[model samples]
Target: METREHSATAGPDVAPPVLTRIPARMDRLPWSRFHWLVVVALGITWIFDGLEVTLKGAISGVLQEPGTLHFTSAEIGSITSFYLAGAVSGSLIFGYLTDRLGRSLFFFVTLAVYLCGAFLTAFSWNLWSFILFRFITGMGIGGEYAAINSAIDELVPARLRGRIDLIVNGSYWIGAAIGAASTVILLDPAIFPVDVGWRVGFGVGAVLSLFILFLRRHVPESPRWLVIHGRSDEAERIVSGIEGQIEKETGATLEEPEETLAIHPRKSFGFGVIIRGMFTLYPKRSLLGLSLMVSQAFLYNAIFFTYALILTRFYHVPAGKTGLYLLPFALGNFCGPLVLGRFFDTIGRRQMIAGTYTVSALLLALTGYLFTVDLLTPFSQTALWTVIFFFASAAASSAYLTVSEIFPMETRALAIAFFYSLGTGAGGVVAPWLFGTLIGTGSRMAVFYGYLAAVVLMLAAAVIEIRIGVKAERISLEKVAEPLSAKK
Candidate 1:
């Protein structure tokens, strides 16, 4: 084995390529406080995202009031679309940077961007400023998804990867639950003025985000990424530090790592390589990734983003009271992944993913039919969605898990960004616009049609999973897909 640094601006900078034990060292470690720190620091981004999104949904009705920004229904939907647009743009721009610049750098940069956008959103005076600020916030979150998912997958032992990834992704709903409850208090007429309440919602997200910044600074760079990017010495040092800490924490000597991979350390990898890898080298996995991403994005953004609007518009639920309903919905979503996550590792990815997706789709169809027939009260409607999303949430989280693990390590962040941007573009951005239009029509059948569309996409994703889902459970990422930089 050899370790050396290469300088930038030297043409085709290359170091002595050799076998490295970094990935094996990481994968063989026992559960330790270090893992918890990584989970909390990087995983908390989902919570902030959930908080940002739920706060927006919770305050959507407030924004429509005469005393507030007085946004129209279409304007409300447009705001979500703007957020998705910014996310798409950010994922592409920052995701490439994440792969190029390293995970640790982008996580801090992205969070700072989010905090700025979120704080500025509190001061929004008009619809334009609010939407613009939301877009900026979305950009921050979009980048977080790219960087954090790659880091988590790379660092976690393959045995625990599925459960941890699902649980971390599902933590979004814990923040959703918090945002929903907070909105109930903030939007209360006795507690705060209608105009004042909504600004406070955005302010709370920004404030909470600040605490996460301190924790993120402690999480180290991915050792896998480091070794592959011509920084083997740093990778070795970081991994060794983690092992020392883990042994101290557990008070046990660690076993030696048995597997090591030989990799060529390249200073630069081009987009052409990634593009060719996706389309030519691994085509089926690419399709599977897209299918999962698109379906879940459409379903979640279409419904969750507009829950308040639907309650206020059709169900006539009070704006302030919307959180009460969303509370239960959030609970169901959060619990799904926590409870069902282990199955992805134990029962296997294909069966569990397909089962969850199929069941959720069926429930959505049933709920849509009942909704169109005017048989559901606001309480019952929420209850049905709760049951539906319980499964859907786990399935949705799996989509992220799938993309992160199935691709070559060299292109992992970009692949996630590609699928997320593409999926969110096709499903996430468009669904909100379509649903907002449907809800504005004041026709139950129109909204039912929207539900049916979600059903079809989910069903397609389920079928795709059954046919081509990678049995990636309990398998190291390098085994899942050989690293692009692996020496022949």
Candidate 2:
């Protein structure tokens, strides 16, 4: 297969159209060590996010101890909100920059920012300092979401995109489990001093990030992004390198791709173009993305962030043992995506997305009813939550999958950032704070009502998904959403 580039100088303002085989070349390649490298390097973003969130949740009780920060429940909730606020800001800022700069550049920059924030968090002297550092950490993870997802979707083969995306997103719980398990030792009174243990927990995230930075150095920029941005020479060189690597690993001749894409290469897309394309051109897709993101964000943020408090406040479970309970919850969440991810590709996106969302909602309603009736112990409560989130985790993972693939390549990262920022800003930023205040009231019914609201939003998302979700299974990204620069 050969790339054919033709410069169509229709006008001074218009970009020259270049017909290239980059997309088909990427989509048809067999899975190999190169793909695995991409997964490990890029997918670790979600793991770090999971670690940051679970670390805070695990240490919330420790922060409230008189010997430590002695923060109230409301203050703990506010700290979570501050982190999410920073995420919203970071996604918007870096998401656009990732599009303008390059995927390879921002992933490293974001990880470095996270390392700085997390390391600084270990030495926070007061409530404000802790919140400030946490906010900075959230910004890094938020930026990761936009840059990493776009890069993953572009590089991975079309046949495996759905499952790979789901599994990568699901890996967040691996970090969650790590955070929970580490706290069991870190927060223990016998193992470390009351204040010292919580500090080490923050340091763990920083240390892990420092390691990932070295690994990501080997990953390359997106060829698709390059070709469209008038860097076809670089794009061709990178794709040729990847193809050679994959062929060498398998020791087999690679088949040539049959299809090609024609793109009018440009320097960058304006924010206004992305906004108009998402809302004006793809309205239903925009709504579907928003609903899925908002519902899952609210459900996960509300329940997960405040779960330790629910145990301590209602069931009187000791704060030190909360990590033990979270272990099972994290296992259930991690397993959900691993088990159900393949079905997404086989069963199709529309059906699987709708089914998972609807099922999780119904399960949540039942669990909330059980809690309100006061017939369950801590063990039973955790058990039921584990079951509910089994499906909920998959549902949440699919939300990221939906937004990333359904838009034009030029707009992909910004679109993810826009929806993530909007959805997270609207739902995630307030859920923890709201649920924490509700849990503070010592009323099971109040907390149950919060769960009920999440159910409503989730069920609504299911209906919208059933109505208009894209059937993108096994389809090339270029085919799913034609590039904004594509020429007739």
TM-score of 2: 0.95
lDDT tens digits by residue: candidate 1, 416-440:
8999898889777688779978999
Residues 419-470, candidate 2: write the lDDT tens digits: 8998787677678768978998999999999999999999999999999999
Model 2 residue 203 CA deviation in Å: 2.1
lDDT of 1 at 130: 89
What is the C-alpha RMSD, rounded to one decimal, of candidate 1?
2.9
- Model 2: per-residue Cα lDDT at residue 47: 88
The TM-scores of all predictions, comma-separated, are: 0.93, 0.95
Candidate 2 off by > 4 Å: 1-9, 65-74
For each candidate, the alpha-carbon lDDT, in order, equals 0.88, 0.89
